[model samples]
Target: MPREIQKAYKNQTRSVDGKPGKKYWQNSVDYKINVKVFPETRIVEGSEIVNFINNSPDELSEIVIRLYYDVFKKGNKRDSRVNPKDIGEGVELKTIIVDGVNYDLANSDKIKRYGTNLTIRLREPLKSGQDLKIEFEWQQKVTLTLDRTGAKDDTSFFVGYWYPQVSVYDDIFGWDRLDYTLDTEFYNNLSNFDVNITVPDNFLVWATGTLENGEKVLPNNIYKKFLKAKESKEVIEVVNEKDLEGLKLKHNTWNFTAKEVTDFAFAMSDHYLWHAASVNVAGKDVLINSAFPKGKAEKHKKLTSIQQKVMKHFSEDVPGIPYPYPVFSTFIGLRYSGSGMEFPMMANNGGSGVPVTVHELFHMYFPMYVRINERRFAWMDEGWADFMENLVIHKFFNEDKSNSFYSRFKLVTQGTLGTIGDLPTVTSSQYTGDSYGYQAYSLPSLTYALLYQYLGEEKFFKCFNSYVKRWAKKSPTPYDFFNTFENVSGEDLSFFWEPWYFEMGYPDVGIKSFEEGKLIVEKVGYKPIPISIDVVYKNSKKSYSKIIDLSVWKNDNRTYAIPVPNHDQVESIVLNSDFPDFNETDNFFPPLKDSYEEKGVKSSIVGNYYVEDYNIELSIAKENEALVIYSNSWVWLNTILIPKDSVNFNTSDKTGVLKYLEDVSGRDEIELEYPKYNLKLKGIKK
Candidate 1:
């Protein structure tokens, strides 16, 4: 279905069954940055030297650099709808050196710049299995641009994409030509960094890499607390108000180093709150931390606890893989949009709720560990993160909240499921109009949740863990994700992928008719949906979920019959099963067996009859396997949906004088031998 990534498969760089091909290869680099930030002037000057390694079998004629910060520059193409201000000057190249020779990139006619992408022409071809060192000095006026990498105030800043980063060169798309839009989709190769940051006194630096000279930069009192916090599981205040008030200021350089990371980012603030903690995940001390402004530290008091839980959940639950990074942090500062952005080891977040904390921290396992290009296939990372977000919320917070508006509010109410102007999730993030966030975030998340439900937790976890582990630290196309699930689950999931990703639609399964032990359902929409069956027979009552594969509708067969085995004289067979059905009119068996009272009697179903005079939309809510009908208009029904504690609740007799109870306002009243049209049912709540 994703024909765009087939070239990697054809070239043997990727396999059809979700594994890296025998000829798989990727380019890497080692970058060192020495930068000084003038917070007062809002300017940044940096010198970077990249040791680029071209280990691929082919030769290279040129290189591409990603000047992502240029998205803030005027006249550049941006995915963000916000207006661009020219307060931040575009990157000014001061000097350049290639290997041992100096190249005038500022005046070279061979160097080309277009928007955020720069194409550098090489003097000589860099042959296969060769390494080249490229150095450059540049400066840019720092602007706290919207979305990410912004300054909360003149003296506090979060810096990212400030330096020109080497773009990825892979077997699939040459040079990773995907443009650096405003947000999402950072396709990159694994790179190491050794950064030295120079800042004025009273400034604290938080970076992506591990701090090497913390003992030198931090005050002795705070440095002691920092060391103790990394080894301890409890939250430790590294810098307190006393230290802030008693600081002896001077210029200092903070040195940091990291290996096998995709990129490097750092935040410097003069008056910000810092919280540090640690969690033992996969036998390693992975630091759990958060950084925000003063007086707002209480908003994120439980952030580290949420991080610990998410780290343990994603590592032990579905897709059980170890936490790969040495640190995980949340940095919330002045963000225009109240949102969160995931970075390796750290996240630029806004909300402080535990669910949000879990969502951002779980991203480390996704694009951070399982390095998928978020630009082209945001669903790959966001979908998985959101899916796990609900799962953790279900297991830890409330299971009822997992599939409801209370937990995943953005998911159940929006996206491709039941919204207008929605596009296919497989479409690139740049082209999907209006509903890109919904399609990218929640639709595919629910799709994967449904897939997990269909496969059962065991098979689902096994397949998911295998896929993530296979692609850990590697850039994988979406096809790799599809193929791996099919390979590990031992089922061709093209039925699941095609409709959910390539097609633009939602699930609209309708019950056609029913008789004896067979019920037929019409697939009104292309999505293959799971069906729930609750059968109360004369002999026994059985409640079981049936997962119907998409292959059932592959042949243009719009209908399929599910035979209820050994269940005669059935009482009910509810469809949609309360799983966020957009329309619920045709959701149950015996035609219409739901009872409701919204305002007055808008419609009624006495026994097995549905009235056409005044009708209402009917849906079934299955909580803990008990059926509760939800109605758009007030209505009542008889001979179906009885209370669980009623005298006839377990009865199989069709003709029985059953006493029922109802609540008008507060008091409960009992009625017997009432008209079926005006029947009162128990367990009714408004």
Candidate 2:
């Protein structure tokens, strides 16, 4: 552990048993903000008054504030490329006040501006258990390049990170001073918000928090539909195209209030469709809404329905926690074609699809509700979201468990091992660089899934729920998470946690040899993963499979031997595991090979031989002195099958072997030795 974390433990701010220390405390703020949007001018003016409470033991002279929109400022360092059109003077500060004393704008020593962070030298030191009030007035221009927060189109916008707020001061870190580089997400203090947004008449606002005065801003008929949708079991189209054709707003100010949330965002458009529905979660009606461009209403029609299913699945099934927020909304228009971003109670999604929707909404349980530090430990949030997405997809969409994206992620993970892309999870998002996506989304998620399978459903949720319950709405470091799981599971999981979270290595187990009545397996990788083996008998040609639990690696053993019933009769043995193995070619006992025989066939007899009964088509065409046999039914058959005297051919690989026979009476036959699927077809040449 680092010295800062050790100091944190000594100070009793964080405990060893995976719970907040007795003296744990964090600073927070209460914000009252008002903003006005000018769609025609692409400008947003904002003002805020914040009441900051100093809950930490030591806090003094200076306070840091984050200006998130400064990523668009000229000459600012950014991890993501921004459109040149979006570049401009960042957050123009018009006024700054501290505890009713206005600071001079021309004072050089009083304020320091660097990157996205603004340091305000306080006139008087703020001691422990004290509070101060501050005010700020600023304006920023919205950009056409739709990032997490920008204009999605000419009339549609999703606004986030648009406020001037104090940075987080926690026990682990004095003050989170990391710059908003547009690559990493964020870390924020949970606080209360009272926000009022003003837009032109006929423009509708869907935001983070509950709309405190919906009836005041919306038309009477539209407000009625919104109210009915909250209680109705069916989806209600509150703001359809027909409603927008003649829609007129009675008032322009939209009031909203949210408590104990990390951040807030809102989406507004003059011609967007709004669909909403309600679902029972933890005996409470949680409203789910979807907003999309009016032209793409048909594409996003099922968004609200999918959100309803995701909410219920998360609440009642795996992880098994009640929905944390009162409302869930998804805004489905981004500048990119395929992307999504998650906010407190809202999501800005690009494509109207199930996978992205499931992945984004599942984030509520991670960084949103659990309050993990996404800037430092993105894996804690993104990984779980990625892992749960496949589970939800498999459960609700009936996707095959073996064929789900989660199971297939091993392919992607293994390909990156020993390469620059295989960075450890403990590395910060900024330093991970090219490997950021894999480290944050694949490694941790796959490890968590393996741990889940190791500890059955009951024990896994017990530990999972405890972690969420303990850290909900509070920031937690990676150690806090590891300690919590270890404390709950009543076991030291250092062997499992170290290599996966901190070290740079991969998981691989291969068959060493089969001797006497025992088969020897070697641990070829650093990670401790479960083992799966399949054995075939020579006489009966029957196969027997066995799976060893992950606990077998608890002792850090290098090799293990398992007794087989008929070791001498073992014809072939194959080892397969879901864990991301760097090299799977060595898993076979005798080692699998990819060798094909050369069959020179005459290309003069060019004909199409297809099975009319099964609707399987095969076309043989001569191209560049080679015969290309294309089979429309199966992928393996679409290969270059060289012809010899226009008669017969054969090819074999580890996956399957193919054999073809041509008869003179216009009859042709094909045979494939596909495992568990033996296919033989006899067709006539046409």
Candidate 3:
């Protein structure tokens, strides 16, 4: 029997913290899982039994065990099956045994129910320093979906969180009672994991850790020998060749092992062709592996070459902390709904271009190696991931930082302008919807880009390394990240985070107008990011630039009309012409005409003129003046009367007055006016 605390003490403790304090119990978990696959049935049976070692000074009461069942199974019909569970074949609860005693599932306290996770109450609370063992058996039928584990193609499978696993109990949030949503990230403790996967005899496996039993597979003798090996042994042999033909299945069982991993997933396919290269990252040997179909093996080779280039580039940028694992595997299968996902030493990539592979692989350094609670603060993971990915792409591809990378940051920042009023990163619920790319991915990336601009490259990287080292394998909130930078750079950054993350506002710097040798700029919008204006103007035959100091206007909209000292020589002006400004449409001076307006003018109006009604009016000025006129109408003899002709004549036909002449000869000025004809004439002497 467990020792019970007095009601008075419990009430007193509850009053102090509003719940059980962190000192109530010590929680530590280690998992060992064995998974076997039947490729024909597309069914996977996973058995994971976790050992929870309690070390709290106080006696434990009820413990909650979470089975990530929602990742695999479908919920009931009453609950709309829109979750990952509803899409994939569901996993049934075969059994849940605790300490050799079977508990009644019907009467168990269901803590909370979402589509992906089910929480159950422990039968009896174990005391401090006590141990409890829980075993679960479930079958998963993998299907393709936007989240969770699923099949990408006939041969390659992308599996993750497909089994019932335990949730985390932390000092802060206790049980981490968050429903599995699209926007929310994941939080878990670092624990030891042992996984065993079985597939068709011919299939090759790529997993999270090192292969512990590579030498155990002898020709045609692995299966019989593997059965005799105990679970405690480090090596196991696998031999099953009934399915594969025309291929040697003699050495089959691929035994692997890893320590201190938060999650585990692997891909197996007979059709997968594999290639690997080893690189030294931070004095550690890291293997880079790629897998693709046989016909696309050459493409996989090219991808591996690019991967090496990216890995080397990241090492130079963010030095120290070498890759922990032996193998970094990238599986290229069919395109999934999700672009890319990062695991500890593995990443799933479905991008067609070179940048996608680099982006996904860089995650191994950011959130994967620097483990953070992704569910609570996705920006911490995704933002850093995107930032590092861009750095790698820019560095390796020799891309122009100001254009390709910074231009994209500007575009995404502009796109997310008005959406800041939607919700906070911690409170807003719309983060998981289709707009996730805009809010979660793009906005955070832009924020980092701005940070890079504010702190410079060296200080920004130093702050990044400090944050990664401090919060690795722990849950870090947005405050923790901000504080890390503040502490390292010795500068307060709350002002930066206020508008960038909390509020959705972006910088809108544009050229309001340029006239009379003055460059007028209008800085609109609220977000406080650095303003860089590139003033391009012509000086004589050459164009010169004067960079205006706009960084002072980060807070308020201030109009600046800077006078160009060389006004007479100025021809054209371009504001932020290099495309560094977030919005470039309003950056250019002498604004380009609208497409519709430009198309409206007649194409044949190059040399044509017309008057509403031709009434004969003539005027003459001094000598040496000449005039020329032409009329398409042949009935009227088109003639021009100049100031030099000193004579004037008028026709008196009344209705047929088609002729008029004026001759001033050498006179200084002469003017002719006809009141009856409703005509007036004026002339200038040259």
Candidate 4:
């Protein structure tokens, strides 16, 4: 542990018992916001009241607010590269009020806005356990650029990062003062919201919370269909294109309320179709919703069905918790992010694949439920999601597809068969520079999977669910997560977490030598992973596979010898893990080589021959020069027939060794190993 972490533990921000400290605290906020969007003008106007409670022990000096729309602020710093044409005029602040007092409209030294974050120095210090009400009225233009959140076409808009939120203040970091470079993900204090959005009457608003007043806003027939669709076993068409006939009302307000959420986001469009259905997960009937352009809805009609199945899988099979939120929604905003972005109870998506739907829905479990700090540790969220993705595939698809996908992850990650520049999961996501997906998504997920294999499914699930339950709705750092796993599993996982999470190398273990009834193995890489090997006996010729625990690596054993029973004549030995071996050349150990050979014909060395310790290339010769040749290897010898002319086989004509072997006896197999350093391999006659 680092000095800061130990200090935190001593300070009671975290506990030595692998749980959040008794004195741990987090601030809470309540938002009452009303926003009006002018889609034609590509602008949004909002007025909001934030009721913030200071739950910490310290007195506050300044409050940092994240005005996400200011990312488009001219000359703002960005972690992700974007085209200049995509930038907009930035957010405009029209009015600012603190605790019912109106400050100077233009030049208040207390108010400072830099980049996307605004820091306001308080005139009256907010005491501990006090509530402060801050108000703001602002407008910002939507950009032409498409990202996780933004406007899509002339008809659709996926609005996110549109409001100002108070940065998280925790025991570790006083305030998360980091700017929005869009590299690291977001971490916000759990908040409650009562929001109202007003748009053109033709537009259909699909948002974060349950639609509380659908009867007042939606068309009468559409409202009836929505109610019917709530419990419908299949998808119900709420509002199709034909429902756009009447044009009496000009505008309407849609009200929504959400409790105990990390953040809130919504999408609205003037020309999208609406679909809804419900499913029973965790003894709760959660509504599943979808909205998309009429042109694409036919192709994506089963989205609601996938959502229902995924919800049930996550609730009962894995984490074993019922769905937490009341409503789950999936809205279409294609060409925006090419994937879905998950909020508290909704997902903004551009996917038609089953894996994508399941993967995004799994997000609702990790950072949303467990509330891991993603900006610093994205692997905590992305890793868990990728791990669950394969599980879902196995259950819904097939075991073969799941296995194939699992291998694909291994190959792309550090476990690849060749040297790859990889980083540890403990490294910050923003500082990963490149290879972000492999670091955040593949490597960390592989850790959990390997952990699953280390501890069987029963123990693994118990420990994992314990961590989720303990940290629900709370912020946990990387140390807290690792400690919880060790505390729950009753295993010292530093040996595992050290090499897999805190360091950057992959595991490379192979058999060194096999003799008598013993097999010696060598650890070629820095990583000493748990071993699995298959041993063969010459007498029985049957292979026996066994997995060894990782405790053997505790003594720093470079070469580990495993004693085999009934082992006078050991046939061969091979190594394997659940993942893969980057190199297979050293994977096998042998007593397996035989020193003798069978009689066979040998040519005058038609291919390249060895002479005077040098390789000599030769051209094709006559028919007699090409003779039948048989060659192979073993601990002593496998089998071969040596002929009379083969040994002293016209060494005068063959001046050099064979550089490349084409074929022998109509077979492309040539096996030979040099006893000392140099030896000649004879080529067969044509």
Candidate 4 contains a number of clashing pairs equal to 25
**Tens-digit lDDT track for model 3 on 1-686?**
00122332342321121223333332567788888877766677878888877754445455555445344344432222353434544566677777777655565363334555566665566777887788878776655554334576666676766667667665444566566643455566566777777776667777888766655542334334433332212222132232233544545666667676666777777766555556666766566667666666444557666766677677765534555566677777546423667777777776334667777777776666666666656766776777766666666575434333454454343433454333444433334454555556666776787777778878888888777776555545555567678878887676677766666555567778777777777877566544344333453455555544434564465777777666676544545432234444465444422311333422111122332234332222111221222233321222222211123322111111222222346422323343322344433223
Q: Candidate 3 lDDT (Cα, whole model)? A: 0.55
Which candidate gets the maximum TM-score versus the true structure?
2
lDDT of each: 0.69, 0.78, 0.55, 0.71
Q: Kindly indicate the candidate among 3 and 4 with the higher TM-score.
A: 4
Global Cα RMSD, each model: 9.2, 8.0, 19.6, 11.7
Encode model 1's per-residue lDDT on 1-686: one tens digit a residue.
44546777777889888899988888889998999999988788999999999978788998888887676666777765653454344788787778878876775576877778777888898998899899989998666556467666888888877898888888866777666766556767888999999998788888887889888888777888999989988888777656677564433899988888887778888777678888887788888777877776677677666777777776776457778888877787645324677767878877666667777778887787777777778888888888887777677666443233112322233223545545667787766656666667767777787787678889998888888778888888877888899999998777778777777676777778887667888878667766554555554554444546545676678889999866565766666543434444576655442323311222221221122333433343443223333333432121223433432231111211333334446633323232211333333222
Scored against the true structure, residue 5 in model 1 reaches a CA lDDT of 67
Q: What is the lDDT of residue 32 in candidate 3?
A: 80
Q: Model 4 misses residue 23 by how many Å?
A: 0.7
Worst 10 residues of 3 by lDDT: 650-659
Better model by lDDT: candidate 1 vs candidate 3? 1
**Model 2 lDDT tens row, 529-620:** 77777677887957777767777878879888888888788866666534455555556554433111223443443567767666877676
Using TM-score as the measure, what is the rank order of every candidate, best first? 2, 1, 4, 3
Task: Give candidate 1's TM-score.
Answer: 0.80
TM-score: model 3 vs. ground truth: 0.72
Find the number of clashing residue pairs for candidate 3: 18
